[model samples]
Target: MAIEKKTIRLLILEDSQNEAERLVSLFRNAGQATRVHRLTGIDDLNEALQHSWDLLICAPSSEALDPTEAIAAIRRQAKDIPAIQLLANNDSDDITAALSLGAQDALPQGEDERLVLVAKRELANLEERRGRRASEVALREAEKRCQLLLESSVDAITYVHDGMHIYANRAYLELFAYEDADELEGMPMIDLIGASDQASFKDFLKNYQGHDGHAELQCNGVKANGHSFAAQMSFSPATYDGEPCTQVVIRAHSGNAELEEKLREISSQDLVTGLFNRNHFLGLMDAAAERAVNAGQPATLAYIRADHYASLLAEVGLAGIDILLTDLANLLRSHFPGEAQLARFGDDVFTVLLPGLSPEDCREQLGSLLKKVESNLFDVNGRTVQSTLSIGVAGLNEKTAKAQEVVNRAHRCADELSEGNGLKLFDPADELAAAANRGSIVAMIQQALENNSFHLMFQPIISLRGDNFEHYEALLRLHNPQGEEITPLELFTAAKGAGLAEKIDRWVILNSIKLLADHRSKGHETRLFVHLSSASLQDQTLLPWLSVALKAARLPSDSLVFQFSEPDAIAYLKQAKAITQGLNELHCKTALTQFGCALNPFNTLKHLHLDFIKIDSSFSQDLGNPENQEALKTLLTSLHSQAKLTIVPFVESASVLATLWQAGVNYIQGYYLQGPSQSMDYDFASGED
Candidate 1:
């Protein structure tokens, strides 16, 4: 592979234009491309220091520019450009003085070949310093993310160094009956083990080199209250806080099936609504299907979708949505048998499996339930809100071979309902066609990934306040084998089903970084906003991977802002918070997109320290309405009061711009400005205030 040549921006603190040209020629003659700016005095040097530069070459003997004064100016600006001082005479005292004054090196003048070599070496050193800084930032981000994971893990985890406990997660503290981690810190690891096991544990520790990395041992655990429990302890060698340590994971063998079952429920169930999650629900469906087959019984699945859920969510906020879902779950529980399986499926969908309900009975029951939900006035923060449901019923029979097929058919029927409030029964023909379509989409996604056929487009996030910095949001596009574009919604749905969302997120991040780096190389100070999926939010390795990619591209961390949708961030709040905090720690900004849709969306802002909030497009869509304008104004005011930069997207008309400007939005993006294009060619300066 051939290495691409890089252009270095050089600031020359030389009074003589001729000598500056001579220096530039020397670099060029040595096969180095340079953009040279000559600074004749302190003012010129100060102005030049405002922008980024690869290296600074100072002529110490210049009458107008003093090398020491120039170096001090650069220091005052906090610029990190490597500076080399050219001495007219090769004097030890002068070289020492220059070196002490923050000059990286001093070179004797009149030696062109030596000048080129020293300049090149200094530039290389500058690049190395930048790389190291990026690595340090990445390391800190990784460590922070790891700490978060450890703290949140359900398994009792502890880091031991020299037989002393250095760190312990919440589960570990609870396991040992300690009230706080502070109580366990610096405590002896053996204190938590029974006296009978202490001797064997010590022997095991003495002989353990962690060469195998992971090993489990059965031991007796003693709690703070002197109660002992059987425990299985797994040990692995790990690094924490830059030191070698042993990671101990303790799984208590309480021998209580109920406790194990409860733990499983906590992991697989939704906390707020207490409904089975998508995965857990599907698992239950599979088991129910198997039992139905064994008993030769009939089973029917109902897929319930909330009508106009986006509008409801906007009205209620996340807290209100939670209350709505909980109420809905309770309603389902009351209407159905106790043994009926209910789950919170997708964002606005719910699923119920009735093991013995016939198609007619299932439809009647669900229809009545829908009527009750539609008639009920939900009190959301003193406001009465009504919601309706779309029901799809799929009855299991000899032909229903797979649980997923039934579930998918029910979902499809619910989605295709002409009247949102009515119910539809699944058709076998529709199921077969839908399955084929899904398979085709999955194949397209796989081929796109393997063949590197995905396309990236950038939409300019123009500053309403006339900020000089350029910003663009990176958008991804996928195509089928036939060359027709596949919408992101379709592609992502397929990717998520195939468990490839993380891979897609990684691809976008890497490509966006490469594009941003290339754009920056052309003398533009541009920033790219990249979207991250929920998989990336939970992925502890993403930060480290991103750091390496940024360093490889030689891009500053600040030049990339990672964005997460408000719904996704809420769905995976813990992981989102951790990832955002990690990104901020790495000096990268984060934006919550599709914001202001959730009822009480500000609640999320209180928990997350974000740099930007992209208002949901619904707000923009309703801008023409006076009431919506007021709402937008109010939302923008609240966001600005909290010191958040606001970005309003989907600005399709000039009429909306006036309202947005009046609302004091910090940034705006939509087709009206420019749709996502193959190039970042927006004239941001033209729209400056």
Candidate 2:
């Protein structure tokens, strides 16, 4: 089957981040961008399963998780995510075990072509199953609506199976002068006709059984009161409650315009919140996008999510949650008034589209609304539940080409918020820049590499204690012809896509070594932590090349600490373990940035030897929250227990300094001390707190 979707939402149960990327790259290379989340344990798996996922690829069993348990979790959630086990070494026993654990297929880890093949097949099959389920649900809903219309309909209608009355509407009962439908349910169609017309009615029924279209006959009808009346009866093939039957309508003059109108109204409305549904709202979004792009109109789309929704679910049962959502919806309706399209995106999530409004205007409106929601106490089941909102706003301006893309950007902004009761406005410039420069980015990168124009900046990783250690993390930067800076994220993403990541990594490493050696010559035992791309982790010759470069610069290998993201190390666990081992042999230090992001971060540590571990910047960024502060303290204790020096980055204020000191963090880096600079001039000996 051909893969039609441009994006695939994937969940990987692999502990290694490099391996996960390998799977993701397969989809990317096949023109399918992926939104992937790697699961490290059952908890991570369970949390990720809350969202819709296309595929699950996991190791048969790892120290962090079991594939069987992951499958069980998916089942427990009643989600239709397809699971496939990626086997190590392709052992027959492992294959048998993985299949027995309910994996769709067990395949070797390195068979890239075959893996894509099976994944596509499974994705296609999953789509078919979801489609079938949706159709089934639609059929059931349609049946209920039709039954409702039949009951309220003015025309006298009855259903007959095998010449015996199976069902009769209220109109039919009243037309036959019966008090209730049960009195006519078991009665035969022939019994309802007068004796004078029974023969003709029997003939009409017999002929209509062979006929596919409707047939009508003028007949005398006998009521339950034994009174006869001239009536026109129409017969047509129909199904009632899954059984084949013939519908008989008497004097059917009125049509079903009212029922159709009711169906249309409900189809566009959400039953829970009484707001416009997702499908209808998306149509409005598309129209807004078109207006923004073609008619020069500007609109703002806001994605609002109720914070701590899972906790709220625990506080209120499903029915109560619905009531709370409805209350929230009503508040939104009142706040927006008219012309603003409000929709229930999903459970506890709402979307508001403000037409003819700039993002700034929208932000102001949302800010006011945010305060109202935060202060207002919602009543659910006679209990008060106060919840905050996280709103992400994006402008549907001339640059907005796709409504879905705008939705994704707004959602991403909301998800990126560290705290609740906050609003984030998505900057469209970065997205526009990336797209506008995609064609020239590779050329710019090549020019930078050939001309040796790439430059590095340093940010001091200061010690929380009064130690005289000068440490900085090296940051890479690039400038285009317009003198605009391109972030390392954008550069590396383009480089990897263009297959220049390895060359770029080598360039950064060589330049970093030279700069560190020069900085140390000034009688400063300065140490620099340089980031390496995932490509460099897989480069078997990187260690040997680094050894030559360090010797050439006459710099001690330990002074130039090499750092890669935790995700990179996890994705290429085997290579990371080997590279770290090789670096250790060369007396070099290695550190993992974005550490503690994995489900079992320590599980990756078990495979490699590293001297320094930098906690993910989010931990430092969200230190204001007590739970985050405690989590950071606990993580620091664990790292210290392992004899590993922990570095906390993104320390932007004095407020977190006391916590870091109490947590015993070795080093801290952020704007609070000093921002990145061309020179390593941070006065570490100043003794400033």
Candidate 3:
């Protein structure tokens, strides 16, 4: 069956009535059902603008109604109507003027095919603009309703931005003894805290910044009457008036712990199924994630969706579906009792959180529930409706970053069920396998190498030994057609598979040298650490080519440090040794990066006498571990003994400075000093002083 499209509404303003009729006929002949109205004068256009319109066509000026007056009339009425002008002849100036006067396009007379094609495009664009306007209106209405709900809510709520209250609900105002919201507006939230609690509140606020999830603090709140009362404030991330802010809900502290628990339970329960609501279930997930990531505990989340929900809803109405959900919730409650949180996550999906359970154990338990649900018949208002489930299980461990990720993974697993009534576990390997196929990345790199469109980013490597020399690590970046940056790891890996690694290396070297030469011309003595791939290490032709390029750029060879990773050097040790010797012959410095990962780290250094040895980032990341710190110190000592200027990468904070300085490391680099940018503007003189 072919679907029918809506009629295109057009408004035409022409000096001759015959031309308007012909225009309508042309549209009809082009297979478009158009309902058009003819405008004779300004009054006619004003009246026509009151109704919906798609496209407007106007004829050349004849002292009656020209294209200018017709388009101006449409604009004055603020109508989303696209206007096209018909010129007497194909004069370029006339077409340009018509377009400048707000016409979508100006077609010369007698071009019926071109006019029809342009009209179709204008009609499509008009429909899209109208749809967007409708959506904006609907969004405004929804925001209004939400504002009304917030004002009438019993919970005391206030939105705070940078510690000042931007908005407060009626309950929030009353809780603080303010007569009106205006009295509380623009007031510092810390002023509401008692003098003794302000310091602790400030500390809590500092820790809560940029963190998700919710936090609660028990403190004393000062009322307008100069009385202090115990208040429990809950903070969560929220947005107000399209600006990100923190939402604080304050409740009076009650000593009746049991009663408080009962109130919390009532608020968190769903009316239809008596299970935990979506918001409360998400809160439990957050707590579970905190335990898993911080305490090394294991947990599992299951997203169970009732299969064929639309068909089931059709079979048993809304009331019957409620009954079915209640029955299913009860069955789920029986299976997951203690320490297991069950929630009505959505209309047809139920979530189960199994804490302290391995993925294997959770799968076994869910498998039994799947069988029970399949065998049992759900009685919906005396009508039996048997349905199955699609369950997705995701494990949460020390590797889990947040709770939402687990929920999303679990939901994705459930959605993978083609025939319904099955269980699947989320596997990290699947994501890795998908990411490994990067044809788009290879294409982007190839295009960049061909067009010389790759961008070079520089991060300053500051010296800790009081050396004032400016050093930057040259990084390569490739943005896809969509302008999204592809990471260096993914970019190079793809380029290598496509045999473009050596080309990319040469491109970086040439560009970096050019940039360095220009920068040095400005009287800044700067050096760049340019990286090379494994393919470049084996390419014996690279050294000779690099010499000619450096000489052409009039840049000193010592200004560039050609760096290759330890893994690459280990894989091609003989090539790396030869490359190191060749770079030395060219008077260019050499650095072996990501060092100390091999079984015999010093053995590779024995063959390749390098200028700089950048220790592996693992040593820096694990500095908190005492053994790792000792390992780094030991590695640095051995390198220093070999006259190798040791540099520790990933110096992410000032806290690691004292350790690195005491360890006698020569230089440091990471975001703490500077991130990769297009400019080499780091102040080496000030830092050295």
Candidate 4:
């Protein structure tokens, strides 16, 4: 079970590069050569795992990554890649718990002697597991399925064991003129043969032994009532009930009579693309996955989806896109060379496998291919339809070792990076670095939320009321290392891209609670709102984090309003509904942000009894424009008539306030009141309103 290699590619997700380097040296000295990449943040982890690696060494206990979180990320990306947690203790209980947390082994970080031994043993186990997965591929095809195709044909078939009739299919019994199945089962092999053919049949049985592949013999069979009939019988060696047996196919006439039926029985390939259809493709994908594991090679499939293909189909018609798919398929076959097993995955997506390749090979080739594919374009009916291939590549490579997770990760990356016509590859390591930074940002954002670098600035909410002190909204901000101030939009966008979205949302919620506490303590408690992110829409439990934060601050949910952006709010409406219902139970105020812009969740406000609708600033930008102004006025009147809802119009300029107020907008927010501050905790320049 020895790993066959010079050394395994390993990575250390340690914030300390020195510690990572020391382990790298130890692995090299211990007969394992490797290139170790060090991860200090969650963002760059994706880059690290876009390929395969032998192992990942992590120290969540040393504040590098929380062991559980890191393990989840590892399983998501490199499922088969083993992870070893460097524990501070050699205690058995700690080791057992680490194993349960998905760590392959827990070894003391500064140890000598057995460290190399432990690494070797884990590597061997990894290889063995990979081998077992490989060998079982052929047997996974359903036995009943094979029997169904063989027995259901309208042809004579009799199974012979040691020259005695073991069984006969219904077609075989019918052709023999046997009264029933039992009459066919117990009869001697010679009984079915014509009396004149006994000697020749014996020769046929003897010659067919140990022979493989196709052969047929012309013969005569004795039917019931002593009738003789001419027939052709085909013999093949096959396994039945764990014993060797001979398959006999006898027809009333020549074998040519059954040739057309045989062709129908072998139906599999997809007709349109001339590739394996769905059932066959899935079986092959499974086989390829097992083969990769068995052969100890990295495996991945590319979900090459044709972006904007639907619109192209609409414009150019089906015949054009059909030729386009055909041309694209030919391009894939040529470009991938001899590496991948290609298949049409239905719709505009096609799948291919690069099986039994090393993790390094798998990664290098996919990366090189992505760059090359950037310039490749497709032509539809002589029209160059500027179409791009947005691919989601998933595999048994380090970042995508499992079947389902690989698919999910690839889809997520493709969807997020669709702005570019070129391929955008993803590795979880990229997300891990950003996630790691979120823990630090959470602490910093909470403390300085109301201070100079972080304070709540008032933006005027102008509507029918002129510059009313009664209404203003709060925003969050951050300061970069370069002494440049960053808004919540910038900070949150990076976090969302890096998958630190949930953590950032948590930080905003907890800090917002603290802001409410400050306002209540100063006897200036007013409704200050914080916007919820689309990513946070999935986190139903984050609402409970606020309950604890509010209790800690000795404030009620009534002092705060939870604002949901229309897009995020509408995307996962069920999660949003559950969240809203929970907040409604707490008597907390709820409002929809960018209300007019959200097409889907815009409907939620009418049915869910939503409290307020923030007129999206797009209406403000186009207030003077005739088309936009009419749309905004119509929307304001309709929402007011149906719900008489409080409308907080987000105006970006003092110039637009008078026009917006005359347009029937109630509350307005603009630079006239002041811009958003860095803090969620402090209300800056109270007299500005």
TM-score of each: 0.39, 0.42, 0.42, 0.35
lDDT, candidates in the order shown: 0.83, 0.84, 0.85, 0.66
In model 4, where is the ten-residue run with the lowest total lDDT? Answer: 443-452
lDDT by residue (223-298, candidate 1, tens digit) is 9999999998999999888899999999998798799889977989878779888999889888777766776677
Cand. 3 Cα-lDDT: 0.85
Q: Select the stronger candidate by TM-score from 1 and 2.
A: 2
Q: Pick the candidate with the highest TM-score.
A: 2
Count: clashes, candidate 2? 7
User: How many residue-pair clashes does candidate 4 contain?
Assistant: 23
Which 10-residue span in candidate 2 carries the lowest summed lDDT?
428-437
Q: Judge candidate 3 at residue 511 and give its lDDT.
A: 86
- Across 1-689, the per-residue lDDT of candidate 4 in tens digits comes to 11224457776877777566657755543324477777655556666667777777887464655666767787787568788888888888888988998988888876633555577777778888778777555455556666787679887887788898887887887787787878766577887788778999888778888678767988788877777888878888877766788888886764465775655434655555665555665676666656665665577666677777788789889788777777777777777758577777777877776676543455556566555555666677678765666766555743334565555666666676666444445565544434435544433443343233454454434335433223346565666434556655445544554465666566667766766577567765356667777677788677687777777887876766777766555446787888878888887877787676433434667445466688766567756687877887888888778664456454556666666666677666655555554433334345435
Model 1: how far residue 591 lies from native, Å: 58
Candidate 3 ranges with C-alpha deviation above 4 Å: 1-6, 13-50, 61-64, 88-96, 104-128, 206-216, 237-244, 256-258, 269-689
How displaced is residue 61 in candidate 3, in Å? 4.9
Candidate 3 worst ten-residue window by lDDT:
430-439
Clashing pairs in 2: 16-570, 16-571, 17-570, 17-571, 18-571, 18-572, 19-571
Query: Candidate 3, residues 335-409: lDDT per residue as tens digits?
Result: 886879899999999999888987778777889998999999888878878989999999999988989989988
Rank by lDDT, highest first. Answer: 3, 2, 1, 4
Residue 548 Cα positional deviation in candidate 2, in Å, after optimal superposition: 1.6
Clashes of each: 4, 7, 0, 23
